[model samples]
Target: MQSSFSPLVAISPIDGRYQKQVNELSGYFSEFGLIRYRVRVEIEYFILLAEKGIFKMPAKIKPAQLRAIYEEMSEADAQQIKETEKTTNHDVKAVEYFIKDQLHQLGGDEVAEWVHFGLTSQDVNNTAIPLLWKEAVEESFMPYLLNLIATVKEMARTWKKIPMLAKTHGQPASPTTLGKEIMVFVERLQNQIDLFGYVPYAAKFGGATGNFNAHQVTFPKHDWVAFGNEFVNERLGLQRMQFTTQIEHYDNLAAHFDTLKRINTILIDFCRDIWTYVSMEYFKQKTKKGEVGSSAMPHKVNPIDFENAEGNLGVANALYEHLSAKLPISRLQRDLTDSTVLRNIGVPMAHSFIALKSIEKGLGKLLLNETKINADLENNWAVVAEAIQTILRRVKFPQPYEALKDLTRGQEGITQKSLHKFIDGLDVADKIKNELKAISPQNYTGVEFDY
Candidate 1:
């Protein structure tokens, strides 16, 4: 808190070179952020207890005063909590004690003991983590993702009619529109992003061991399970995991991670394809004055942005995979592994944010080389063999596939003249020959898509 952080001295690139791009994530994923969320949960739980008549709130204790404890918590307050943690050696306990002190100062000392009543550290943690994660996704992550999707959508529509050769197994198989190729990723990404809505922002809120043992034993007439469900669902806007151990099952959280990993994987594929296009001169990147594309080669303009995006996306996916796999497992009732692992949730999110920004920038700099694309299609006249054979079959021609293969397969420089000659010599009528002659790589692309 007294200032030791500097970009030059930071260890991870997320906090160093790329910090400016993803700094907003600190509000939800930083150490101070974690403490603030914990304080929010503790204070909210206390207010809910008073509202339930679990304890009596004095007239002087206004709801605003209670909320202000967390809403207005400053760096100094978080630093104070860190100092307390240094002595207590328990982070959540530090937050609890900090709230108790706030309550005492507000002349509500009588109910200060109820600040974290009948709760274990996990009750505060499990709730706070999901609440912060939900906010981060909704407020921070989704906007960029939606904007990226929109940008891609607009690009797709812009290139909707542009035809390019389609490659399968690194060889030209047929022709597809550039827009449809881009839309493939767009559809895949949207499909996965939509799944986030179904994966609930889930939290575990029952007392220690998830039984609410202490709450029920103290108030035998009250249904503590119902209270937990309401507190987590109604109050926090998160789904409560009805059954869990000392920690939340994290199945929903893992689902979210898996979905995110898939989105990143799609983006990686997109980046690679775009990079290939740039290499093939299908895309010409815009150059800025005084910007060096390569130190050794002055004539080169590299696709560094797409390369950056691919690298960061790969890193993010690795972390997401680990998080999805590791978070759902713990030693019996609980383990400290998740505690440490969960703290790093923002690391992958930051990497992903950086990669998304890079991809957006890369896309902005792309200058579509329609000439190159059309030239590629024109050069690959052999690709139209598929269309010719398919049309011949429609006319009930004899062995149409084999005939077309003989003319195209293992043959170079199969120009339109040669194809026309082949069609003219066929045993079909002039109408059929004219129809076969009409087929060309440029016009042989499959049906147009409405999306």
Candidate 2:
């Protein structure tokens, strides 16, 4: 039976309203995707066994033919496995049966018994889940994030010379370049992205209970430990966990979730900052034809993209927190909890992917309002007090901070004339007074960065 599930009827927004943005993720995290990965693991393990001479394969059976079982896996194949699961009441076992049925069709029934030999469900699951996750991160997630960072960097470079008032505790405090402010997020995101390398894409391939008891009892002479390592590390390109329970220990997996959560948190911060900038009119959005930002308000152009990104990032962070906290703690050796939780690994990923796309779109639409930015600088002359006071301090002037504070603090209508008047009254050299007059909010920004 074909899936009648359409986006219109889907429950989650990731699958419904935002499905188009995240459709590519289904290939990595969907039920069919999971089943396909299981098939791949089973076939590869069987081929490894054959290469090790653990079983005599028919001379006619080619490795390519075995590999095609998974490479050519279709929705029909996944559905057949699901049907088998109904009878077996076990998902991994259904995959094994499906592979055996394929081998039977290929005139290699003799080797079919060796498929998934001496392995429990965790052996396939622990390896497959992490392997697929590794692929998804490298292939999809990292690319999107890198692209977003590049966009941010480009914007930063463009506005590197643009001065804007800085706010601390929601009040104008100092002056900073727009580029430097944007670059802050770039450095923060890159720092966390680099940490991904430290947390390994770890997997467990040991047989039931973290030891190869079945393999050892059947063939005590074979080095099953080395076999497990080579299969998981070399063949699958995943870091093999040497010691584990029936399930993977999941500490490394938790680390991955935490790292992802931190990344999302940074994105959330970026979204809010961008939204605030939009509200401040430092940035204007390019209005689309026939698109309404607000139904009732005609002149409004809302920062919906950043708003969407923030909301999605919030949802993604919540899921990441649960996944990170829950996956590491299980009942003694193993339990069913990680199995269900592991399946949801893709849920937060899909949300994060959507948020990334939203952020990219939001960034692309930003039109820097240089007039507004400059006007803001011009209006907030009080910010220059810091520069004047700091220079006064450098000159060993008495009560520099107090003097500047008295002139600017809570005093309304402080303008160029008023500040210049105060500067002329200072008991300092003409050069010092001239220096103070030159320091406006626009030029009060600190040293230029190489951004």
Alpha-carbon local distance difference test for all models? 0.92, 0.91
Give the alpha carbon lDDT tens digit for every residue of 1-451 in model 2.
2366898988998889998898888888999988988888888899899889899999898999999988988888999999999999999999999999988888998888899999999999998999899999999999989988998999899999999989999988799999999999999999999998788999988899989999999999999999999899988999899889898888998999999999999999999999999999999999999999899999999999999989999999999999999998989888798888899999999999999999999988999999998887778888889888899998899999999889999887888888899899999999999989988888888889896
Q: What local lDDT does model 2 show for residue 48?
A: 92
For model 2, give the 10-residue run with minimal summed lDDT. 1-10
Per-prediction TM-score to the true structure, in the order listed:
0.98, 0.98
RMSD of each: 1.2, 1.3
Give candidate 2's total backbone clashes.
0
Clashes of each: 0, 0
Q: How would you encode candidate 1's per-residue C-alpha lDDT over 37-112 as one tens digit per residue? A: 9999988888888899999899999989989988988999999999999999999999988988888898877888
Best candidate, lDDT: 1
